[model samples]
Target: MEPHIAFEDISKIYSNHVTTVAVEGVNFQIMPGEFISLVGRSGAGKSTLLKLLIAEERPTQGRVFFEGRDIATLDGSQEISSLRRKIGTVFQDFKLLSNKTVFENVAFAMEVAGKNDEEIAEDVPQVLELVGLSDKINNFPHELSGGEKQRVSIARALVHRPGVLVADEPTGNLDPANTFEIIRLLLKINEIGTTVVLATHNKEVINTLDRRVVSLDKGRLVKDDPRGTFIL
Candidate 1:
């Protein structure tokens, strides 16, 4: 089977007052239906790699391919929109609308994607249920616990029924119990066939996952191990 995503000699360099190489000469492939942990420290290029994959930042050199298409070449707004519909992203900070309720927050994503009311009405509730937030649909982000807020974030990400889920430091703000809950949710998402690329620095989370691990250090690919542990 072909790789679901591939990074070929990827490098991203940022220039301003100072020059910073976020990533350099990185190469890896994510197979379909696989869960891979991207492990690294701060400034280790994990986030830069993700940005390249999503086309948020074009690589300074090399290519990032999603399902065999170079994402860097997706320059049109329509193309990027279509690509986003296929990849769901969850961030450490729950980027929910402060004034919107849980249901509305999830529904907003569909709305932005040009989903009609009927589609949003049907899909929002179903995704909320999938994330175990059925009863809290009316709660605001301020009213929910840290875990509940993150669940809502996950729910929003899944509402698109995306083929790939990219979660960056998803459990960064949660306590141990909530962290495990989030990890379990991610694993469950993976079990159902979504390609999950989880970029996290949590050692315990990495060790416990025991899945494919791609480690980076100082802007370079350090290791790619199947059933890997946290070894940076």
Candidate 2:
């Protein structure tokens, strides 16, 4: 099968008074249904790599391909929207609306994607259950614990049933117990066939994952280990 996601000779440079190289000559391919841990130190280009994969930023050179199509060349809003819909994203920050309840938060994603009220009502509850948030569906962000908030975030990301899930520092704010729970949830998501790209600096998280490790240092691809540990 073709790669679900591929980065070919990728590089990103920001020019200001002085130039900054975010990532350079990075190449990797993510197969369908695989779990990958993107490991690196702070400012090690993890964010830049994800931005390129999602087309949030154009690489200064090279290409990002999703399922055999070059994403950088997609300039139309419809095309971009369609591409993004296939790749769900979860971040360290929950990014939930303060006033929205858990149910509404997850439902909002479907709404934004033009899902009808009927579909939202049907799918939102199921995703909340998947993320083990059925009990907190009516709770507000402030009312939930950090782990619960993150679970809601994961639920929202999965509501789309995207083919790929990109999680950036997802457990950054959680305690050890919560961190482990979140990692377990991510593994469960991966087991069911969503290609997961997890970008984090947590050594223990990477070590315990025993998944594919793609390490970056000073903006360059340094290692690609199939069952790797975090050594950065």
Candidate 3:
């Protein structure tokens, strides 16, 4: 089967004053419905790779294909925008709108995607429920706990039934209990068939993932294993 995401010999270089190579000759494929983890130390190019995947940053060389279409070949701003709709992202800091109610926050994502009132009304509630935040829909980010805020972020990400969810250090700020809750939710999402890609520094979380683990050191892929542990 063709992979949902393929990073072919990906490499990135930074230059302004002095040149720096961030990622070098990295190749990987993310399969649909798979739970995958990328582990590495600080400034190890993990974040750079994620940014490249989301098109936040362009690769200096190499290509990324999403379902066989070169990501670089996306026709225009509109096409790139549409591609993003199929991908959801959760960050270490829950990027929720401070003043919006949880329901409105999730609803806003669909609204921007041109979803009509009926669709937004029906889907937002289901996603909120999936993230265990149905009862907190009316609450603002300030009114919710850290875990609740992350759940709200997760719900917003799921509102579109994205084909893949990329969570970058999602549990970085929360305590262990809350971290585990987020991890459990990611696993649950994977079980339901959305490919999950996690980039994190937390060893315990990565070790417990029990999934395809890819370890990156500096800019190189040092390890790739089916039943991998977090050895970063």
Candidate 4:
């Protein structure tokens, strides 16, 4: 079977005055419906790898393939937009619009994708329910707890029903209890068949997962473990 996502000999370098390598010849493949974690210390190139996958930043060398097509070659905006629609991304920051209500925030994603009122109305509530934010749909970002804000972010990300969800440190700002709650929600999403790629530095969360761990060291792929732990 083919991998859902593949990084073939990928490398990224940035130069202005002094040159720095963000990722170095990293290669890995993520299968469909799998939950995987990318573990590394600060500045270990984890973010760069995700950026390459999303086409926010291109690889200085090699290619990133999603379902077989090389995303690096996707020059057209529509092509890139189409690829992004199939993948949802969550970041450490909630990235919620402070002015929009919970429902509007999630609905905004569908609206931007050209979904109509009826579709947005139906799908927004469903995804909000999935993230345990149904009752808070009318609430603004400032009116919610940290966990709730993150849930809203997740809800917005899932509004498109993406095949793959890339969460980069989704629990970074939450307390331990809330952190676990968010992780459990992610696990539930994975169980329901969304491929989840989580990049985190939390040892307890990573160790507790005991899932596939892709370890990176100074921008290089150091270890790929099926039942992996957080070892830096």
Question: What lDDT does each candidate get?
Answer: 0.92, 0.92, 0.89, 0.92
How many pairs in model 2 have backbone atoms within 3 A of each other, for residues 3 or more apart or on separate chains, i.e. clashes?
A: 0
The reply for model 1, stretches above 4 Å from the true place, is none
Measured against the true structure, the TM-scores of the candidates, in listed sequence, are 0.96, 0.96, 0.96, 0.97
Q: Which is better, 3 or 4, measured by lDDT?
A: 4
Per-residue alpha-carbon lDDT of candidate 4 for residues 1-232, written as tens digits (9 for 90 to 100): 8999999999999998989999999999999999999999988998898888888998999999998989978978898988887888888988999999999999988987889999999999999988888899999999999999999988888888888999989999999999999999999989989999999989999999989999999999999999999999
Error of 2 at 146 (Å): 1.4
Q: Name the lDDT of candidate 3.
A: 0.89
lDDT (10s digit) by residue, model 1, range 61-153:
999999999897886988987887789888899788889999999997788788999999899999998888999999999999988999999
Cα error of candidate 3 at position 206, Å = 1.3
Q: Which has the better lDDT: candidate 2, or candidate 3?
A: 2
Please give the range of 10 consecutive residues that has the lowest summed lDDT in model 4: 82-91
Please report how far candidate 1 places residue 195 from its true position, in Å: 0.4
Runs in model 4 deviating more than 4 A are: none
lDDT for residue 9 in candidate 1, whole number 0-100: 98
lDDT string for model 3 (1-232, tens) is 9999999999999998999889999999998899999999987888888888888788999999887888888888888888778889888888898889999999987987899999998999899888898899898899999889988888888888899998989998899999999999999999999999998999999888788999999899999999899886
Question: 1-232 in candidate 2: lDDT tens per residue?
Answer: 9999999999999999999999999999999999999989998999899988888899999999999999977978888888888888888987888999999989977887889998999999999998888999899999999999999999998997999999999999999999999999999999999999999999999998999999999999999999999978
Quote model 2's TM-score. 0.96
Better of 1 and 4 by TM-score: 4
